[model samples]
Target: MDRKTKIALGGGCHWCTEAVFQSLKGVNKVEQGYVASHGINSNFSEAVIVHFQPEKISLKTLIEVHLLTHKSTSNHSMRIKYRSAIYTFSEVQQKEALSLLDEFKSKSDSNIITQVYPFSAFEPSRNEIQNYYRQNPEKPFCKQFINPKLQLLLQHFSNYVNEDNIKHTDQK
Candidate 1:
């Protein structure tokens, strides 16, 4: 678990997910990209690839972070382009992911549609796309959508994120 485990996750739009993961304590990096494996079947889907430290965090925690985001803080871009997913790098991770999803559904108020499968090649998104929300926090999309999600993070999951990255704007 010393090495970072790569988890390919798509939670609607990559911009905000990148912003969100960048604020995490154990997430080494959140890569914006097109999952070539997913794109092979469709003409319109985009994705986010997350590389995180499993020693500092767990895949279950990663999934929880994504589920919380997609459930309560998403908009049309994610709805149309992104679907909740975990692209696994190993068979053990695959089993754990499904088990967690099943357990989560049983305890939750609503059903989840998170897709889990094996990993494949990905095309990295360009430099400009990385941390787009932070770069343009005042943009209409960031102000209205990503801001609210950040607010939710500040209000509720304050302990889970990298508090050093939390800004003055996060003050409530």
Candidate 2:
């Protein structure tokens, strides 16, 4: 069996992030939840633990997709609640994520504010609210907030997308 790795990501609403990761090909599970890093980031923030097989999808690709799907550059008022961060489980992942972010920054006109932090703790979202998008795809929140992210995924990273997990009608 292939070894699976997990990474926590936070940028936008957890619902949106969860759905976006769920639509990916190599992602085995997306745990929508709250995550806290060390130091100043001790407070829990909306995030998702994406469990995936690196052999099937590279971390570089996952990080790239994450950067594009959310407001990685924007330092908005709700940043406290929605931190722009990548919570890495290991030293290697941390270094790789930082390098990827730096490389991404070099190519962009705007500064990338996505922080790379060591994973500290995670509290899974309440059962009723977990997998919000898949259960409530027709709801306004899913349609308005999540559908676009999935569309962007299909547009730019279709090769890594699991088409079966996505409802094409939601893209309309």
Candidate 3:
């Protein structure tokens, strides 16, 4: 069996991030959750823990998709809780994320404010919140916010998308 690896990401809302990663082919699972907490304070930024097949999808690709899908350059004033972040589980993951950040920064003039931090803990979101886009596609928020992001994923990362998600998206 292929070895799987995991990474935690915080990009705006967990619902949107979870939906995007779930569509990818090599992603074994995506759990919406809160990460890097501190007891009752629970720095608990909305995040997703992605379990994936390294042979099928490189961590670099996942990070790239993440940066592209979210507004990494925007100030967090509109939604302080939704700051962009990449929480690494190991030194290797942190290095890869930082390398990607440099690469992305070199490519674009916009400041990439996506924070990189060591992974502390993850508290899964309520069941109702998991698989949100799949469960509530018709909701105005999903249609207005998520659908476009999904379309962008399909357009730019067509090879990474799951065939089932493509068919489901097509039927809509």
Judging by lDDT against the true structure, name the best candidate. 2
Give each model's whole-structure lDDT: 0.70, 0.92, 0.82
After superposition, candidate 1 runs with Cα above 4 Å error: 38-44, 71-80, 168-172
The residue-by-residue lDDT of candidate 3 on 31-133, one tens digit each, is 8978873343247788899999999998889988999898988876844477588888988889988888788878988998887788888889988788898
TM-scores across all candidates?
Answer: 0.83, 0.97, 0.90
Clashes of 2: 0
What local lDDT does model 3 show for residue 158?
88
Q: After superposition, how far is residue 80 of candidate 1 from its true place, in Å?
A: 6.2
The better-scoring model by TM-score among 1 and 2 is 2
lDDT of 3 at 122: 82
Residue 6, candidate 3: C-alpha displacement in angstroms: 0.5
Query: In what order do the candidates fall by TM-score, top score first?
Result: 2, 3, 1
Per-residue lDDT for 56-166 in model 1, tens only?
Answer: 877887787778776523344454467566677788888988898787777778667777767776777788777787678667887766766677676767777776654
Cand. 3 TM to true fold? 0.90
Q: After superposition, how far is residue 26 of candidate 2 from its true place, in Å?
A: 0.6
lDDT of 2 by residue, 1-172 (tens): 7999999999999999999999999899999999999999999999999999999998999999999999999999999999999999999999999999899999999888999999999999999999888798788887778888998998999899888888743562
In lDDT terms, how accurate is model 2?
0.92
